[model samples]
Target chain A: EPEVTQTPSHQVTQMGQEVILRCVPISNHLYFYWYRQILGQKVEFLVSFYNNEISEKSEIFDDQFSVERPDGSNFTLKIRSTKLEDSAMYFCASSIMMGDPYFGPGTRLTVT
Target chain B: SQQGEEDPQALSIQEGENATMNCSYKTSINNLQWYRQNSGRGLVHLILIRSNEREKHSGRLRVTLDTSKKSSSLLITASRAADTASYFCATDNGSGYSTLTFGKGTMLLVSP
Candidate 1:
C-alpha cells in the first residue's frame, strides 16, 4: 500500500534556529494535515490543508509555524524559531476523502 | 474538557483474551477513527466509525459508536502479544477535510 513519507526522521536544533520538516503524502491524496504529540500526551492537531490553502488550524499553530506545498508531492512545515516546548513527534497525514487519514512515520524534533 | 477522552488509560491481558477500550467525546463529530501506535512509532490507522453508523468491524477489531451518548468502544478479540500498543480515538467534527482532535489514548499490553 502507498504510504506517506517524511524526511529527516530525527532533528536536533538550537532554540533560536529554524527547522523545516518535509513530507510527501500519497500521490492521489487531496487533503493533508500536520499533528504533533508531546511525550506521553495526546496528539494535537496543528493544521489542515486543502485546495492549496489552509482549511483549519489550532491555537498552537501560531505565527512561528507555516506549511507549504511547494511542489506537487511535497508538504513542508517550517518553524521560524524552535522552542524547547516545541520538541515533539510531528506526523504528516493525507487522505483522498479526508475522513480516514493515513499517517507517516513522523519526524521527531528535539530543540535544545 | 477533552474532546475524545478514552477510559482505562492502561490495560493488560493474556494472549487469546479479549480487550476493550472505551472512548467518549464531548462534542458532536462527523466521524471517529481508531489508531494504534507501538512504542516510539507513528500511528497506524485501524478503523473508522461514522456518526451515522453504529458498528464497524475489521479483522479482529470491532468498533461501536453511540452518537446519542457521544461514546465509542473498540474491542480487540483473541488478542496476541503483538497487539501490545497504544490505542487512540480521534474525532473529526466536520464532514470532510477538517482537523481532528485526539485523546490521550489507552495503552494496552498483551502478554503471550
Candidate 2:
C-alpha cells in the first residue's frame, strides 16, 4: 500500500537554530496534516493543509511555525527558531477524504 | 479541552488473548479513529468508526462507536506479541480537512 514518507528520521538542532521537517504524502491524497507527540504526551495537532492553504491549525502552531507545499510532492514544516519544548516526534498524515488519515513514520526532532 | 481520553493506560496480556481499549470524548464528533504506534515510531491507522455507524471491522481489529455517549472502543482479537504498541483514539468534526484530536493512548504489551 502507498504510505506517507518523511525525510531525516531523526533531527538534532541547536535551540536557536531554524529547522525544517519534510514530508511526502500519498500522491493521490489531497489533505495533509502535521501532528506532534512530545515524549509521553498526547499527539497534538499542529496544522492541516488543503487546496494549497492552511485549512485549520491549533494554538500551538504559533508565529514561529509555518508550513509550505513548496512543490507538488513535498510538504514542509519550518520552525523559525527552535525551543527546547519543540522537541517531539512529528508525524505527517494525508487522506483522500476527511476524518480518516494515514500517517508516516514520524521524524523525531531533538532541540538541545 | 481534552477531546479524547482513553482508559486503562497500560495493559499486558499473553499471546492469543483479546485486548480492548476504551475512549471517551468531550464533544460531538463526526468520526473516531484508532491508531497504533510502536515505541518511538509513527502512527499506523487501525480503524475508523463514523458517527453514523455503530460497528466496523478489519482483519483482527474491531471498533464500535456510541454517538449518544460520545465514546468508542477498539478490540483486537487473538492478538500476538507483534500487536504490542500504544493505541490511541482520535476524533474529527467532519469539517473540511479537519484536524484530528488525539488521546494520550493506552500502552498494550502482548507477551509471547
Candidate 3:
C-alpha cells in the first residue's frame, strides 16, 4: 500500500536555528496535515493544507511555523527558529476527501 | 479542555489476551479514529468510526463509538507481543479539511 514518507528521520539543530521537515504524501490524497508530540504529551495539531493552501491551524502554529507544498508530492514544515521546547516528533498525514488519514513515520526534531 | 482524552494510560497483558482502550471527548465530533505508535516511531492508522456509526471492526480490532456520550472504545482481541504500542484516539470535526485533535494515548505492553 502507498504510504506517507518523511525525510531526515532524525534531525538535530541548535537553538535559534531554522529547520525544515519534509514529507511526501500519498500521490492521490488531497488533504495534508502536520502534527507534533512532545516526549510524553498528546499529539497537537499544527496545520492542515488543501487546495494548495492552509485550511486550518492551531494556536501552536505561530509565526515561527510555516508549511509549503513546494512540489506535487513534497509537503514541508519549516520552523524559523527552534526552541528547546520545540523538540518533538513531527508527523505528516494525508487523506482522501475527509477520509481516514495515513501518517508518515515521523521526523524526530531535536533542538539543543 | 482537550478534545480527546484516553483513560487507563497504561495496560499490560500477555499474548493471546485481549486489550481494550477507551477515549472520551469534550465536544461533538464528526469522526473518531484510533492509531497505534511503536516506541519513538510513527502513528499507524488503525480504524475510524464515524459519528453516524456505532461500531466498526477490522481484523481483530473492534471499535465502538457512542456519539451521544461522546466516547469511543478500541478492543484488540487475541493480541500478540507485536501489539505492544501506544494507542491514541483522534477526533475530527466535520468541517472541510479540518485538523485532528489527538489524546495523550494509552501504552499497552503485550508480553510474549
lDDT of each: 0.95, 0.93, 0.93
A1-112 in candidate 3: lDDT tens per residue? 9999998999999999999999999999999999999999988989999999999998999999999999798999999999999999999999988868899999999999
The i-RMS of every model, in angstroms, reads 1.1, 0.9, 1.0
Best by lDDT: 1
Off by over 4 Å in 3: none
Output the better candidate (2/3) by DockQ.
2
Looking at model 1, residue A87 earns an lDDT score of 97
Tell me the tens digit of each residue's lDDT in model 1 across A22-105. 999999999999999998999999999999999988899999999999989999999999999999999999999768999999
Give model 2's docking category.
Answer: high
Q: Per-residue lDDT of A22-78 in model 2, one digit per residue for the tens?
A: 999999999999999999999999999999999999899999999999989999999
**Which 10-residue window in model 1 chain A sums to the lowest lDDT?**
A94-103
Q: lDDT tens string, model 1, B56-106?
A: 999999999999999999999999999999999999998457678999999
DockQ of each: 0.84, 0.88, 0.83
Instruction: Give per-residue CA lDDT, model 2, range B14-112, as digits (tens).
Output: 999999999999988888999999999999888888889999999999999999889999999999999999999999877667688899999999999
The full ranking of all candidates by DockQ, starting with the best, is 2, 1, 3
Which candidate tops TM-score?
1
Which regions of candidate 1 fall more than 4 Å away from where they truly are? Answer: none
**Between prediction 1 and prediction 2, which has the larger TM-score?**
1
On DockQ, who's better, 1 or 2?
A: 2
